[model samples]
Target: MTDRKLALAAWESLFRAQHEVFHDMLADFDGTDISQAEYDVMLTVTRSPDMTARLRDITANMLISQPSVSRLVDRMVTNGLVTKCADPDDGRGSLITATDAGARAFRAVATVHGRSIAERMSALDDDELRTLRALSDKLRRS
Candidate 1:
């Protein structure tokens, strides 16, 4: 195969393999009890000091759309894991805040996710980890 064609094929293969490994790792996560999207939103909201963020803030980094985020926030609110509030700066916008209970839940789920990542990635040497990070970043930027 030509060098360029071979390289592209290798990249595609590697990307798929990486995605599969991530899915496997996610499957083993303690937050498997929660949908990945839900866990992501909760973690983001709870990590901030205000423990609150606008709907637009959540949607930006998330994989889902604003409407989906709103619906998920609604469900989380109903579950008592989060509460909806008016954005102080924008009354028309909604802000999401984790409850004390939500914070506790996020902690529990984070532990699980952390453990899964640690266990699966533990075999990589420091140099390998650095190389992986560089490569991943390069792909992200591209």
Candidate 2:
């Protein structure tokens, strides 16, 4: 049996916590060459083999709409942070690859961002983190 009141309370707490944490973490991007969105895009791209990823894959991983991702990718390309080209296998799709400059920028911000995340998450113990991860994953899956 599920308690509706309890569930709603839990959801409200979770949402508020996430919002606050995200807001605080926004500082990590300040003075960086790339915005958070660009970092997110490159996070997907650099993780892929050869530092390349399908545009569709990037779009899938992002929270923004497909058209927004396309526009952002174009801006990234113009800034020389990444290269974009038509996908070889999918004529209608595109591929995004991080340029050397882009990779460097990502690494720099990632180092600072990783530290910031660790510091913030230190509020929870390792076991709590594992539990949080599991619960978050379960929610996403559901």
Candidate 3:
């Protein structure tokens, strides 16, 4: 194949692989208090100190758009999963913190999801996983 064709083929393969893996992993959220998106946001929040993060930071980390993330965070607030407050440092910006309930829910789901991810990814050896991670990071940087 020509270089362009080869690149297209590689992209297609990567996209399909991601879709399949994501679809399978999404099942782990079934019967959980949070959807995949909420879990994603909570994951970032939980990783931060005191389970708090700026809304902009969360938006930066999430794949969703800023408006969508704002709406989602509002829903999460309504569901008692998290709290949204004005950023003390920046009045125009907002801060998000996972509630105790949210933390509990995240922990409950994370245990299962983490294992599921590991099991699914086990098909790739450590070196392959590392290479994949590096390549993904490179792509994101680019």
> Model 3 over residues 27-95: C-alpha lDDT tens digits?
999999999999999999999999999999999999999999999999999999999999999988999
lDDT of 2 by residue, 12-78 (tens): 9999999999999999999999999999999999999999999999999999999999999999999
Question: TM-score winner among the candidates?
Answer: 2
Q: Candidates sorted by lDDT, descending order?
A: 2, 3, 1
Where does model 1 exceed 4 Å of error?
Answer: 1-7, 29-33
Better of 2 and 3 by lDDT: 2
Q: For each candidate, what TM-score against the reference?
A: 0.80, 0.98, 0.96
Q: What number of backbone clashes does candidate 1 have, counting pairs of residues 3 or more apart or in separate chains?
A: 0
Clashes by residue pair, model 1: none
Clashes of each: 0, 0, 0
User: For residues 1-142, what per-residue lDDT tens digits would candidate 1 score against the true structure?
Assistant: 5599889998899889789877896674442445677788987897777898777888887988888888888998998888998888997898888888888877787888888777778889889989989988997798
| TM-score winner, 2 or 3 | 2
How far residue 124's Cα lies from its native spot in candidate 2, in Å, is 0.4
**Quality of model 2 by C-alpha lDDT:** 0.98
Residue pairs with backbone overlap in model 2: none
- By TM-score: ranked, best first: 2, 3, 1
